[model samples]
Target: MTDVVQNGQAKRVSNSAIFAGCAVFVAGMVGAAYASVPLYRLFCQVTGYNGTTQRVEQYSEKILDRTIQVTFDANISSGLNWEFKPARMVNPKIGETIQIEYTATNRSPRPTTGSAVFNVTPMEAGAYFNKVECFCFTEQTLQPGETVKMPVVFYVDPEIAKADETRNIKTITLSYTFYPSEPGKPVAALPEGNKAVDKKL
Candidate 1:
């Protein structure tokens, strides 16, 4: 009877240990699942994988003699009643900073808000496409029938002409998509009474 009691206690402890181990593993997996998205995004931003462009505060260090045709593309998510378009194209000397603009008009009778997400094409060249200033990542709200112009100042890094993966690339396309913002979300602080307009842009 003494030996049996000891075995039963040991068995219970073993079972408890197994359950605790499984619980810890599940918790870890759940945490990892939650972190995967931001981690992947950071990874993409760092490596310029999947056409994720780089954001820079200052102008390029140098400008190359060769010019590259940079094109613009715009898109609006469904349910957002807005007309969005970008200037067709511009040729800028490598590393030359230039500003291009996009126009957005709210067609709905009621006010609406939106946020823009952007990316670059020729995924390999994304690493060299840099934005000095952009209206993206900000909530934009528009009054009924309002039109506004948004600007993006950007430059192609001169390193594009030297990187083995991007050398010989002649064109890069930047694209944006606007999605409707959820109600009750914070609106961007615009100058009082600016209808879909940003003076800084």
Candidate 2:
């Protein structure tokens, strides 16, 4: 009788342990689902070159020409407070690099953390995108009212000069949009089937 009681008690403990473990697993899964949707959305907004919002895709051949327009669009989805600025932009002839600066702020009442992703599509030009320095590609945490300056350096492939379609183009605007990022979450790819402006020749 004593042995049987002991065995029953051991079995009950084992069952309880299994139930607790399953419960934790389910909770984790639910949390993941909740966090994944927004991150995915951010990914799409950053990567998708859809023409609805502002984007950069062209450059003037005149190096001394400062006539290029720098466009800005603000995104606050991740509860992030931010700003972007042009540090310095050079209108290179054909084989020169362009550099720009961006600034971000944490306007939230509480501490917040996230990352910004950026994409540049040079319409009618084939330029290799390079990041000399930027805050958009990494995770950043800001205290209340804290602000930081970010920089990006990129060059337009001179080969674009060879294309007649890009020769007449007088403007290339570099645009940046901020997106929220979280660990263990999947970033969303740009929206599919949306009519994206054809920047490619």
Off by over 4 Å in 2: 1-75, 83-90, 126-129, 183-201
Residue-level lDDT tens digits of model 2 in 65-138: 22333333434554455543445445544434456555666777876666554444453332323233344544
Q: Would you list the clashing residue pairs of candidate 2? A: 40-188, 56-173, 57-122, 57-123, 58-172, 133-151
Provide the overall lDDT of each model, using Cα atoms, as 2-decimal numbers. 0.82, 0.50
* Model 2 residue 177 distance off true place after TM-score fit, in angstroms: 1.3
Deviating ranges (above 4 Å) for candidate 1: 183-201
User: How many steric clashes between backbone atoms does each model show?
Assistant: 0, 6
